[model samples]
Target: MYIIFIGTGWFSYVFSLVNLDIYFSKNHWDRYTNFAELSLHILCAIGIYIGRFLRFNSWSLVTQPKHFLSILPGELIGKFPLVVIVLTIAIIAGLYALCKPLVAKSSLYRE
Candidate 1:
């Protein structure tokens, strides 16, 4: 279930990025759009850590938001969580770079 959920997140994140490139940047990514995309990747990486290790789900964000937010800084303070987030960010950004062209090139279907 968690895998499925994360897959959804990845798909949504990718489409959001493509849309940003298309609409926000007028088909070309600007510095601000790139910044926003990278920031979101970092946030999602942190979210993955929180959900996996801390066992907080989407409901926790609504029901126990204060607790959730409170734990994050302390939890992410150490080297381990920092390493996880950084590595996750690298994976996400790296794959996105590799896949963006494939996504854009999917116009291979017959007209």
Candidate 2:
């Protein structure tokens, strides 16, 4: 877990900036990208909750597809999953909002 979610999340933002630099120009800073990012983060939080609590890693989907899918529905629709996913998204978003300006001002960032 420590190795997986080590950073406070500046790393992911920086990686996205690099991806934009590669695909589009460095000047491409779309506001809608934030919405897309938030949506992705929410989904990822749900997945993380599933993986952590249910012990269903990525390989479980491929190796044990039937069991994984069968159990997924039950695991997903409940108060625990909802609370965990929401809290994870909230923390990451809050940290992003608090630290983004600092990230943007760093030498690693570009206009």
Candidate 3:
């Protein structure tokens, strides 16, 4: 589990770098984005450590209770698209990782 999280975090970091290079070729690199990416990687690493030491499932979707009732509907509406994109990317990446070993084995057998 720790290995998986580290691998995923490293993969995500590399992917983000590639994306930044392609999309921000003409513009200066945004420090906030860099920080956010690094922080996320660290968070995953920490989560893996916690899971290993505390025997918790690190991949579980743990949500925090928020005061959504007090928040304006407009803010939630604006965040919907961003949430969708994040979830989509996460799902795609997870699927890719899950399939990678089988794909590699199949290619090796074919060759």
Q: How many clashes does each candidate structure show, in the order listed?
A: 0, 0, 0
Candidate 1 clash total? 0
**Better model by TM-score, 1 or 2?**
1
Global Cα lDDT for candidate 1 = 0.80
The candidate that wins on lDDT is 1
Compose the digit string of candidate 3's lDDT tens values, residues 21-78.
4454446655455554445544554444435433446334343214322332333354
**lDDT for model 2, on a 0 to 1 scale?**
0.73
- The prediction achieving the highest TM-score against the true structure is 1
Off by over 4 Å in 3: 1-13, 20-29, 59-111
Q: How does candidate 3 score on lDDT?
A: 0.48
What's model 1's lDDT at 1? 100
Judge candidate 3 at residue 37 and give its lDDT.
45
In model 1, the Cα lDDT at residue 103 comes to: 62
Q: What tens digits encode model 2's per-residue C-alpha lDDT throughout 40-80?
A: 67877887897899988989989999999999999889898
Residue 28 lDDT (model 1): 60
